[model samples]
Target: MPDNRERDRKDHYLPRGFLKGFIDPANKDLAKPLWHFDLETTAWSRESPGSIGWERGMYDYHPGTNVLEHPDEVFERFEREFPLVREYLLRRNFKGWVKQHKHFLLEFAQMMRARSPLFLQQQTAQNENTRIMTVTSVGPGNQVGVDTTVPYPPPARFIRNRTITAMREEIKKGPDWMENFHWCLRYTRSVADPFVTGTQPIVVEGRYPNSNDAPVLEDALNDHNTIIWFPLCWQACLVGAVDRFDEGTAEAPPSLISHVRGMFRRPSAGYVISPIKIESF
Candidate 1:
């Protein structure tokens, strides 16, 4: 008989299996039609010539070359004028003293790029049958289910899902797939504020397969399945957990949660993380 333990060890690192959970039929609501949302921003800058303005139409910020003169007013205007951008900035604590710092605006732009459909759509377009969906909102404070004094704003919450077929094709390109996926995740982390973590607005209902229960790479490839789900903000936690596991340090990392037997589970259904680190760099 095949040793299920050995199979799990090998399948744990297979990206295909991980991707399948996102597009499973059971997750259709979370995988709502990609065309429902309109991401177009207003060109708020065009009307205000020679003044630092926000292009509400195109969702671009015009610095007017001297944005430092009135940092507070500039940011305040952003908050009052551009609701979406304001929500994202507030989550990162971009106000008062923080507004004076260099790289504030640049960081805002980077955050928008990471949260926007621009990059995902570009990547998905490369594949013939792939599509991308991005949902953005400012979360309600009470809605997060975590006790905190701070109010969660809309536009700060972003969920991105891309057709898994694109990811599979990239995986077929040999080891490059690993690099590409890791790079994408890291880039996202770098651009986002540390406080900005993913939220599970849509609950996926299904049985999450354990690492040992994952399908083999060959089977996963032939299955032609896809997965779509929110990207959780457990990268740091994951790294910490894996590090402790690898070094055999004292107990499991505190970040490790929802453990069932050999696999570590996420709050979202059908997503599992193996104890060992699956990708590097």
Candidate 2:
């Protein structure tokens, strides 16, 4: 066998910029490692039956699940029951969402307090719940596209209609909504996939060592409603958001197609060899 000194060297095992170097070389192919998920949402699409609006007022009530609604006589007896009535009304709405998707409802309930206060008190209090609901659809298509058929609006395009519309309206009158309004999901997939490969926990050391630098990294990837399997071979895979493409800088918001193409490039594996003036034995 040829002498294995080169292979056994510390530099060989702990290559300089190992993760970054590896990904840099094989980025072309590795970038294309399937980064989308197709969500299946036919069962939990419609409004739940136990909905309690003015017309629909708690019909089919279960023991532990249902909130108690006092009768007209009872309401009149206790003049202070209006507060309870309001609480019950709001609780019913919150619990109704839980009846549909229990898992997410739990997560949303836990994070309910940490949300920012909005204009609509009743709705804003449950905005985290709304986010959980909204993200359910957006989460799937996060990296690739939130593939769905709810018929009202597609989640990927929904952001444009919802968030962008608000921003544009604010921008027309020259408001500082950009700070308040942010693109919810940027350079990250909310859904989890199992088959496809992706990167994780990537830490980039900015070129300017002492500058206020933030190196972005791939956060999540999904495929077929499962977290994609990112083969450990892929390294230093990062995600960045740019406002414009071909702007001769990295600050432009890379479009979906460009971002996808950037992730899935060829020569996505192996090493780079620089010509050195070492004398071979």
Candidate 3:
């Protein structure tokens, strides 16, 4: 085994710079706190960006004594360019995306899907839920025969091994949205109903014909009706849908924010993040 000593222990799924967008505008303090509703405790608390959203050694895979494959650096690089994307988003300058900016934004979206606790939970659950069966029969000539069927869900060790090396491959291929959909940036002007996010920052739902249903993850992917919402900060969100990709600034319709807020209460995530204390939720 490779030496695992002296490694970076804090694996922050939600990087601080990305979460910084949700800081309340009224509080201009450098050490501003974010309000979070703990799903596990069923209580609210305040925390800094660096203190929350991390698990110990989630991504510390070692193949050599001194070498480390850090998504850490790539995450920081993506966040460094985030402000520019946010600037263009808030300004509704959708055309401002040069090749590099577009690349960063799309890849960040893919990372948001891959580099979260929710992703791990989903992949692990899919594997563990896999079922196998065995059948036994008696031969006419007093010989016994048996058959076994193994399903496609990979073993847990295989999953972990792939996760360590797959980040770059996934980044290179990018997300389905990058290839197929146009994008939208949504800005909510109301302070009372600012956008809220979660540990699993990327949330998805179906629309129109299937609005009442949540989209299935795979197997005939419901991408055509799926709508995704990613909270960029307290004021803005990035949205993508099959039908429309235009950006806009508007107050979320009366029932909309409440519905979206409910969607962020993912079972896998321990908490929900907001810019300010929200008693109503």
Candidate 4:
């Protein structure tokens, strides 16, 4: 029999079992199709021409065992933003800090990557049979409504009966699939501010753009089968309840909610740490 870790890990990967039910069927049954983008295939740069002084690649971390490995490359940009943040540690005076907080920091990075479809989509693999659904907001600004839907199907049915349970089952099948199936959904009103920042009210494209095709919000919300309802139940495991709600945010320490909004921004350059609260059935 599998222990809780094994059982929980299993639930984390497969998209058809627990995940299917975990995401509300009505939400999943929408008409919107999923959108997938290949980060390696596209050219990514800072979203703004003059946006400066912040970490360049802080938002690109992926979850799983390899989560720590990305710090070296991404941290370079972080150092550029805050030299003292890293310099103080290089002296090794904070070995105790490293010991106690290293894992927490890594987990935080994973949450950042997990929250962004830009990063999350990059981590996903192609499966013609498995339908992909994208979950993101709609409209000119972040005020846009949250919608769901299925994506254009592949040549075959690699996946069936999509759900959070099934998504978790798929992840446990192998270690490499860790970052593909899950996401952090932290939707809040204040976080929507950036999405609707400009005054002209330009027709905003979908938050996530895929290499294959850009599926707009209206298209995504229509197909529920492809949609995976944001799973709130899963958030606690990645981020503790206290830090997630109180201290982490665009303001007030910024919670995962703020990060999720940042990741969904148009031409998002960096990543934000969003709290993923997966809803339980």
Estimate TM-scores for all models.
0.16, 0.14, 0.73, 0.20
In model 3, which runs have C-alpha deviations exceeding 4 angstroms? 1-5, 30-32, 62-69, 91-103, 124-159, 207-220, 245-251, 266-269
**CA lDDT of each candidate?**
0.24, 0.22, 0.66, 0.27
- Once superposed on the true structure, which residue ranges of model 4 sit more than 4 Å away at CA? 1-95, 119-125, 128-281
Q: Which tens-of-lDDT digit does each residue in 55-108 have in candidate 1?
A: 121221122222222222222432243334433433554333123422332232
Write candidate 3's Cα lDDT for 28-138 as tens digits: 475647888898877898888888889987766543433344566556667677777776666764445434355567678887767777666554555466654444777
TM-score leader: 3
Sorted on lDDT, highest at the top, how do the candidates line up?
3, 4, 1, 2
Question: Which candidate do you rate higher for lDDT, 1 or 3?
Answer: 3
Clashes of 1: 25
The residue ranges of model 2 lying beyond 4 angstroms of the native Cα positions read 1-183, 186-257, 260-281
Taking all chains together, the TM-score of candidate 4 against the true structure is: 0.20
TM-score of 2: 0.14
User: How good is model 1 by TM-score?
Assistant: 0.16
Worst 10 residues of 3 by lDDT: 211-220
Q: What is the lDDT of residue 269 in candidate 1?
A: 26
Q: After superposition, how far is residue 60 of candidate 1 from its true place, in Å?
A: 34
Candidate 3, TM-score vs. the true structure? 0.73
RMSD of each: 25.0, 28.8, 6.9, 22.5
Per-residue lDDT tens digits of candidate 4, residues 31-145? 3211112123432222221121123322332222122222233324322432233234324433443344434333333332232333223324333335555446666665544
For candidate 2, give the lDDT: 0.22
